[model samples]
Target: MEMIFIFIIYFVIGLLASTLGAVAGLGGGIIIKPVLDLFGHFDLPTIGVLSAATVLAMATMSLVKFRKKGHKTDKVVSSILAVGSIFGGILGKVIFNIIAISLNMPTVTGFIQSATLALLLTLIFIYFIKKDKLTSFVFKNRLIILTIGFILGFLSAFLGIGGGPLNVTILILLFSMNAKNAAINSIYIIFFSQLSALILIALTTGFSSYDLSMLVYMIIGGIIGGFIGSSIVIKMSNTQVEKIFNISILVIIFVNIYNIVNLLY
Candidate 1:
């Protein structure tokens, strides 16, 4: 009964987080990691692994749904950014593992991740609110775009926050993309980043040791959320989507701040 209840909770968390995440192109790990961490239900590594798996599922389903809707994505931008994210994913995970091994203190890592995420989310919330007044830049340089993607991947992977708010923010402010295109490209980038992270994790820890039942519930929730979120976004205007995105970022910022405080003590 206890295990069943736990799974049910995770399923609900997955559903809500993925739904909001998909709407905002976050891929849900930003919410999952801190929420689960705050609950104290799983250790740090397990939470990170599960969060990655869940977000990967969400990203895959969301991208498929977008493609079916005839939403045109910039393949060149997506491919180049995704390739950069793959390499960044590897580097991020490598650094994370090193930190874990070096300090032998999981709480320290959690504190660092949560603190960084909180700071980033706060900044995102601020910039997003005032972005309309700012001039958006467009860079034709492939190297610059790839470098941006690498930074996105590194922060998201190392912090286990999926693609984070920076993906859409960078895409919009730097690449001059609108909200809709940025979201789609963000999901595409997250898919490859999470995939690379998962492959690295499999090579290291092996998924066999994790709880398969929990994985199923979380992934199922993510897929359902992906489908629903995609359908909802199709009907929403760019303004509506930006509203949702801003709201989600604000909520996540508070959650992460709480997690950071908890980790510190």
Candidate 2:
């Protein structure tokens, strides 16, 4: 009975997180970790593992829905980003293990992650607010986009996020993609990054003993939630989608700030 109850909780949380993630182009990890942390049942590394699994499921389902709806995404761009993210994900996993597991300095790592997140979100928020004045800049070079993908993947893995927010924002700023298309493409890019990070962590740490029953439940919920969320996103206008994305970033910024302060004192 107790086990069943826990599974139910995880499923519900996954549903909510993935729904928001699908709409906002986030990987749901940003939502999931804070909720799970409140349970006090897992450590940071374990939370990272579980969240990555959930994000993979969410991204996969969201991408399928987006493609089914005939949402056009640049296959060439997606391929380039995926290739870059693959390598970046591996590097991020190595760093995460070194700082959070090997060194056993989770608090310090949390401070670092939250601080960086605060900075990233602040800049994104400012850009969204002042985008009109900013001259549109589109990178003609595929190499530059690939490099940006690598950096986004590294940050996503290191911070245990789905890399959606960062991916979407960069796509809009660098490629001048509208919000709707950026959100769809972001999910595709996130699929590669989160999957690579999961594999790397599994290979290095060996998940032989960590019971993933909860993760399985979360994945199930993520699939269902992603479908529904994508449907809603498909109906919304680009402007509305951009607003939601920016609002989510502001919320996440506050969350990161709180985490940073807690870690410091």
Candidate 2, residues 1-265, lDDT tens digits: the string is 9989999999998898898889878778877776665565777887888888888888888888888989867778877887788888778878988998889998788778778878988898898899878876677678987887788878888877777878887888888888888888888888888888888867777886565768888998888888888888999999999898888888888878877777777
For model 2, the stretches where C-alpha displacement exceeds 4 angstroms are 1-5, 209-213
Candidate 2 lDDT at 246 equals 88
Worst 10 residues of 1 by lDDT: 205-214
On residues 97-152, what C-alpha lDDT tens digit does candidate 1 reach at each position? 77864567787888888888888888888898899899999887899878877877
Model 2: which residue pairs collide? none
Worst 10 residues of 2 by lDDT: 33-42
Best by lDDT: 1
lDDT of candidates 1 onward, in order = 0.84, 0.82
Q: Tell me the TM-score of model 2.
A: 0.93
lDDT of 2 at 79: 71
Error of 1 at 146 (Å): 1.3
